[model samples]
Target: MRNLLLKLSPFFLLLALFYHPVNAQNDSIKILSYNIWNGFDWGKDLDRKNKMTEWLKEVDADVIGFQELNDFTPEKLDAWAKEFGHEYSILLKEDGYPIGITSKQPIQLKTKMLGGLWHGMLHVKTYGIDFIVVHLSPHDWAFRRKEAEIISDYTQKSVLMEENSKLMVLGDFNSQSPFDVNYDAQNTFSLKRKQLSDSLRRAKNGPDAYQNLRFGSIDYSVISKFLSLPLIDVVQKKQADHNKKSFPTLVLGNNLSKSEFEKNQQRIDYILVSPNLENQLIHAEIINQGTPDILSDHYPVQATFKYIPGK
Candidate 1:
């Protein structure tokens, strides 16, 4: 009878191990999204890189999504990430302006879609959460909208497959959100953008550029798609009334006048999370304080979430 009971105890232990929840304790995680301005101005100016690396370490995000990794190799990114204590890293591609993801935890590459989109999309999973990092088209509104559709379609299917999926879609969107009232009220940015678009068009197609140019200064189509996925814009969710513009920092140099800054100021970077993780968000903010412009053209965005690791 004792021998039989001993064998049954081993089976019971195995069952318990299988049924028990993994890392059930609630933990918190920090995620950062930054464009890094053409890979810290195309990897020139070592001082800037050092400063950026120090800032990254200070922020100590669990996962970071970077855009404009212009000339970085996989090993280069990995080395840079290691300086900030992130051991794992992945780059979408080698050529053009590549995007990359770095994490303290092991990152599982889920998808890498670049053919149809301008900058491309990278889907990676870490710490029991799926993160889709994107840098959409910056040149045209219609092209950006199309890119948004591709991202939304994929995310929609992912959401459908797992109702309680903990996910985040974040990066340099390069488009305005409807929720930002500042953009709606201010015509300075819109006018400037339209003028820039028209100039580019004219350059490409001679004087007949007006025929092909359609600039919706305050376009919502790109951002609205992600919102329709029911993903919460962390900035809006946290600071509903505060106007936080994420671009055109001191990268244009510290000499810009107040009016010039205002004209270029806009929120082009974002960190959007799935509804399932919305309630878990602790805080979100644009990292604009203290020489942010020197590090990159766009300020880095950080969000903290209550997470259950290995879930």
Candidate 2:
């Protein structure tokens, strides 16, 4: 009877352990991608700046990426990030294209793989978890191909070789999803694109293999295809809105007017992560879409994720 009681004791202890509150820590991360409308030669947006501040304050994300940065100085962006209690920022003002990233935790920049025209990779890790923040060009198709080549080259030569490095290419990629089959006539949610084909063309010559993920609506598949890395999109798993269009903002202030910006529609922003990191993705969203504050002309996109344990 005592032996039976002792065996039951272990089972009950296990149950009690599950019930403990101390084990509540999550392995996921909260990430935000904002094309903060800055630098563009529009009517100076003081009101919009305040709106941006308020919006960002409400977001409460762990990592943030901002685009269209011809105006905001690195010092100013750093100051703004500081307002959010963020300790790190990487803002550039070169070319019509500048991108920046801010994080509460320190990001170890893989400087070799980052910035030139496109922000390639900002490597960061928190508590044994690893990530690489990437911002791609948001241009027409032909130009996209050129940028894609650059990014693909950088990724192959740079990130894949790193030990345990989980890559995430998240930001505006300008090109539509026509290259992907997942979207109907309206190409919105697809991870795979023509870049996948381009990457495949070079795979045979590369040291490692690759996968093209346009097979799915989520960006994880695209990262899986391009980098040959293991990962998936967690937001799609918990949500049923598979057809949700990643409606990019219409550029309203410059040569692009309100109607011009509203005319064409597609999901330009993305979050393509390593395959192993997909299951950890918890949530993602497009911020302040309907309401336009002239922060550049595009809406900000953000994602939350957890670093899964034991595969």
Candidate 3:
């Protein structure tokens, strides 16, 4: 089917869509998505943020996508991010599931993807791409489809008409991908096809491939393509929400085995991203500052990106 589609869809293929650099000079930017496990721990909040600080110093990650802001407002988030040298932070208006965006550079509010129950999509225009850092719920695939549909309509003109406009929809896409589950009993559509759009599937090497998060070997840490607006994921680095190897064996227990870790553990965080500035790709991955005691249960994912590329 893939071969047939590749042949038939070649003409319809988004060949002209990968916007060429209209200008000889180009600027670069980096954006990151993370679930920071933020909460009101009262007196120990400073120490709680230590892992975040350590990761920022090491990874040099500029823009961050954060979930679980607890009760922190945008102002409070900014103040807290500042401890790690992050200059700006924006928390969405969602109740408990607030998502935050932090950057070393100034973040300008562009627009928002208003539909869907998964928090909200933060529309930010930078590096010639309309970047939307999202946090999708794991509740069900129906919500995921709604999220995709909303984004599709939002970028239809700019991204679909081969305008070279880029749109990146990334976050903790809570649901397992299509193939990750058997065919939904009621839905006749191929489980994978129903959830992720065609553009996302084609970004990588294979059709049946899913972002190899959690249970797998390290491959290219993304599903990116130059032509499409929702180009690809940044899984090319074998990245995850947090690192387990950084944990101490003693804390896990005296008698831990491979099966024990696999069953009891999971890398449940993500840092998926779209293409932008190469220099901004300083380093992206889970921050392992040793024990899980001081660190947020889920490590704060980090990446160092410059304000703009070639600056």
Best by lDDT: 1
Q: In order, what lDDT does every prediction score?
A: 0.81, 0.54, 0.49
Model 1 steric clash pairs:
none
TM-scores, in order shown? 0.86, 0.64, 0.57
Which 10 residues in a row give candidate 1 its minimum summed lDDT? 208-217
- What are the root-mean-square deviations of the candidates from the true structure over C-alphas? 5.3, 11.9, 17.0
> Which stretches in model 3 have alpha-carbon errors above 4 Å?
1-31, 38-46, 126-129, 157-167, 177-230, 237-258, 263-294, 299-311
* Candidate order (TM-score): 1, 2, 3
- Output the better candidate (1/3) by lDDT: 1
lDDT of 3 at 64: 68
What tens digits encode model 3's per-residue C-alpha lDDT throughout 1-311? 98988787866666644332322333334455555554534225765566556755565444667766777776778787887767666777646667767766566677655456567777765444455666665433345556655655665554445443444555555533221122122222222332444335446646454432222221111211221343433433544423322222223433556444333333334444445433245555545445433445444444434433321
List where candidate 2 sits over 4 angstroms from the true fold. 1-27, 40-43, 93-95, 112-140, 178-243, 250-263, 288-296, 307-311
lDDT of 2 at 97: 51
lDDT of 3 at 114: 48
Sum up the clashes in candidate 2. Answer: 19
Candidate 2 residues 1-311, lDDT tens each? 99999989989999875431211357556776666654534327667776667767776667777666656676877887888767677764454556777777665554535444454444444333445455564422333455566666666567666665666666666544333334334332222344555366446646233323222222332333443433344333443343333444444434545543333344566666666566566676555355543454666666776644321
